[model samples]
Target: MRRMLLTFCLLSLLPVTYAVACLWDSETLEQERNKFPGTLEVITGNFPRHSPAFYQWRLDDRLNKLANDPDNDRWLDDVAVSYEKLGRHSEAIEVAESQLQRNPDRYETLANLATFLIHDGQWEAGLRYIDRALEVNPDAHFGRERYQRLLVQYLLQNFPDGQVEYPLAAGDRIDFPTFLVNDQPPGEDGQPPKLSIEQRQAAVQGVVGMMRFSQHDHPVLLEVLGQLLTETYRPKVDAKQLAARCYLLLADSAASPATQAAYEQLAKKSLNLQATHKSGSEGQMGLRAVRRELSGELAAAKKRYNSIVLKEKRWIASGVDVEAAYRQYVNSVQW
Candidate 1:
């Protein structure tokens, strides 16, 4: 308990900054995206979750603003977003389509409309729009649209008969590697080629996009987040410990007791694997202390999430770039 408190204090003092790769400025961030042509670099810190009442208020507010100034098409995006949040995808689709008709080449409208279509279960239509959005501005949103494209392809491969469901939860239902690899040839050593940085970025982007637009704690996205972090990489935190936390969160949020146990077991396996890896610094803290620190970080993150999201006051961002703890939670743990 004392160690946990001390760890919490250390975490509390840490700055609440986002990953360097995900700075909110689109133009400046695009410079980073250019380095990796097709991969996504999601700021996951931009799209904060809001209550339905909050979205309704936003929708009403935007509608009023548009009423006063009919030429302001930007508000249309907000209106569509609000409708999407309220689970009125048909209305969202209409608003987005109207905007698209006015500005067919606008990447934001195209991308937003595509996502709305996907959420509405029009996968093919969404995929087509996504392709068009990419053609207009391939690097928009740090190349996030590509990840959406990849997701559509993945889902289509699984349910090829054109009948599918929304908010997909893979949950041990598919072999991820087989689908992701697309039958690529093995390496010269006869083993599968290691995952490229682009592939990892795409996977991370998929998870972020899902959490932002779909369900926040969707089990499948959480599992993918865990799997991605498990790959060897230098991160702000221990990768396996972070992966373990992802699995634990999956277990907690899982709908079934059996699923919970399965994730809990995965978490244990992640922890046990930690012992096999020698302390990288050759003199850093032991594995136990690292796990303790991870626990403190996760607890602090949950506290921050609750503090940001549990407010009674009606709130809306003053601008699209506004920061919220809800958005940073995914970055805090996953990055």
Candidate 2:
């Protein structure tokens, strides 16, 4: 639930069939917007909806339980999560901090604290907590913490203020793979690559975990997942199809028409989807079908995600060591 609550998405000027290769300047964004027909509205209402009242009820219930059993400490996370869902990030952080102060070894509390901090735009602080959480249980969440660490580092390095200046693109072509070893063997010279096979494989696992557990709408996550799929060969996964879905979602969440257009162009150019369609309108029709398919897939994934959370709770009740159990589970299924 924490994973689902915190993840988010973003955009270019495209609709469904394009991809973006580089970041655009403000002037470029405006110029592209002018070239498009009608304005592309920022998409909303598609995600699984939860009412504010539902969160308020959950918060009240958790608070009541905490009042009854002040020493239990279990209710703290529930309260914090409810607060976060209600848009009270400061309160969430406060609750999580108190929980951490009480039991610093608790992995969920550590991760929740990091998430709340990130939600509040405290990227550096969030990174620190994420590091602590990783130390507590690096294998938790299917090793997804590593990717989060890397992502925060990238964001802090490129945009210290935690806001993207323009629509992100891969430039004339998608190129992050150049830095990674991917599926290939080590260089003949026997030198290590910047992103070795192990690292790339682990990062792909993290991205897959995020896609399965978190909301599918977050643009940064989508973009990174798309990039990883294109670069790293994941057995049995349709890289081009999945990457197209990621860009399609990007277009949906784009801030302006120009950004949406850029993503659409990227999808078509990068995925070679245009070669099949006779016209842009035909390509759009195909994209709509793909979008519907992706949405259905997301819904099923959400159900599986909820089941995992429940399974974790049950394991805790049965006195199971969750981190060790999760590590075993990751080992069993990991690529």
Candidate 3:
């Protein structure tokens, strides 16, 4: 009876032990060995030299012979990258994994494999390989940078704020012109009409949402939002209110006292505009509440903001239809 009980206990502990082993061990490379079938159809169709298909053919020809040569390992990396660039992600992953089977300590191969996996939307699994690569060579700069980039990409995508399709990278700065459509007249030679204010707002909102969720501070994103508010002409939208909201968002990520103060000044200008405007009562009240919140009157501001939110179900909210109110207020002040 004692022997049987001991055997059963040992059997039960096997899975737990294995899980623990897998957790601490950098043997994912070993476990992934032979996981993917070693078969890929390389298309050799002729195309322009600059085309991906031409690059694929060239790489495929080299890979066929290089796969057998253990000394020429770097060529294998090139082939894998080319396969990825050509949208042959599965083949890229297979090539990378095969290379790892022969040379498991190749940090570059490991990093490349991680990137391929991430590109294929297998980020969690890919991150394990990144950690393994960094483990093998902590000083691998490319590997480390790739790992951080992947991490940021994952965070931006999975963040609760909003879904973003843009591929973000470190030191990546987007200019305002990139968001603007060409100046061609609408319907001339089939040219599309200019993007509406709502469309621009949506685009800017997507960017701000990503920045809001990003773990890393993004002053560039805040600056871009600020610039958009100041530069864009949306006749209906109250730019001041938008500026105030942007300033509040920027405050969270501001790195210096000067930056914070600048945001505060901008917020104050927006608040003053809202308070002085002869707009709808609800809009004025909402703006006052936001100002109060910014000015450290949190309890009253929260109550007012909450009341506005509760009333949103029945009426156009504070910020909506703000353009008409803005024009009315401006005309009133001017007259």
Whole-structure CA lDDT of model 3: 0.49
Q: Work out the TM-score per prediction.
A: 0.65, 0.62, 0.33
RMSD of each: 12.4, 15.2, 30.1
Q: Roughly what TM-score does model 2 have, to 2 decimal places?
A: 0.62
Instruction: Count clashing residue pairs in model 1.
Output: 0
Instruction: Indicate the TM-score of model 1.
Output: 0.65
lDDT of each: 0.61, 0.59, 0.49
Best by TM-score: 1
Model 2: lDDT to the true structure: 0.59
Tell me the deviation in Å of residue 290 in model 2: 3.7
Candidate 1 structure quality by residue, lDDT tens digits, 47-93: 33466656776787789899888657788888988898888999999
- Residue 160 miss distance in model 3 (angstroms): 8.5
Order of models, best TM-score first: 1, 2, 3
